[model samples]
Target: MRLRVCGICIQNERILLINHSLYGKDTFFWSPPGGGVQFGETATEALEREFLEETGLRVKVGKLLFINEHIEAPLHAVEMFFQIDSFEGTLKTGEDPELSAEGQVIEQVQFLSWDELTQFAPNQLHRIFSMIGSLDGVFHLQNYIPGQNSGLEK
Candidate 1:
């Protein structure tokens, strides 16, 4: 299984998200800004690097907010989501090194308000995003055992 790190940055009542379209342009998945943890790197370091790579921002990673497992045949991943304490830099869409020039999955990167998020289907967004209303509510680890339905499609 691959290990990934995600950063949660809520500013001005908006959440930072990247439009992930790995499957295709029609299947845009809105998710937190993050990517795989590289070899010999800590989760925090990976997250900082991912933010810079995907959002063009230098961020200070905070406490772990959630631990989620995504299993879909050959695409299994263990993702760790953390709170972003602070950041400095202009925000812009960035690229994923893992993808080829023509295979980049990130289409857009921006801060989306809760009202804007609700406009999409639940499955289109990360499940943990549902708890954004309360930081305390999002500060828990969510483990996924294979085959056990957790009510979260993603």
Candidate 2:
């Protein structure tokens, strides 16, 4: 199993997300602007690089948020999700080529409020969303299968 790390940047009740095309299918999934941790680089360092490379913004790494163990076929990865605060530069789009592991092109880089995010595809990583509401310090997400439903708060 490999280890990965990402950062969740939340500001003004909205979170920063990137639109990605996975496996040739255009899925507007929600994910924090972060990437895998390098061999020797710390999570903060990797996040800093990833944020800049993906969103063209500099971020100040904050507290650790969630830890997800994803078993998506041959790829079994343990992900460390963190909270990031402070950044520079106006958010833009398309940091790199679309749909690359190195990092997907920032097709859309906008802040979506929790309420507004419900309008998007359901099962779009709602564990993190729930965590936000419940204030669950850390989470362990497993067997995540995306589906259709309004993942909004009642």
Best by lDDT: 1
* Pairs clashing within candidate 2: none
Per-prediction tally of clashes: 0, 0
Could you tell me how far off, in angstroms, the CA of residue 93 lies in candidate 2 after the best superposition? 1.8
Instruction: List RMSD in Å for every model shown.
Output: 3.7, 7.2
* Model 1 pairs whose backbones collide: none
Q: Predicted candidate 2: what Cα RMSD to the true structure?
A: 7.2
User: What are the lDDT scores of the predictions, listed in order?
Assistant: 0.82, 0.65
Please give the lDDT score for candidate 2.
0.65
**lDDT of each residue in 35-115, candidate 1, tens digit only:** 888899999999999999999999999988667777666567888888999999999999988779998889999898877
Determine the backbone clash count of candidate 1: 0
Model 2 residue 149 distance off true place after TM-score fit, in angstroms:
21
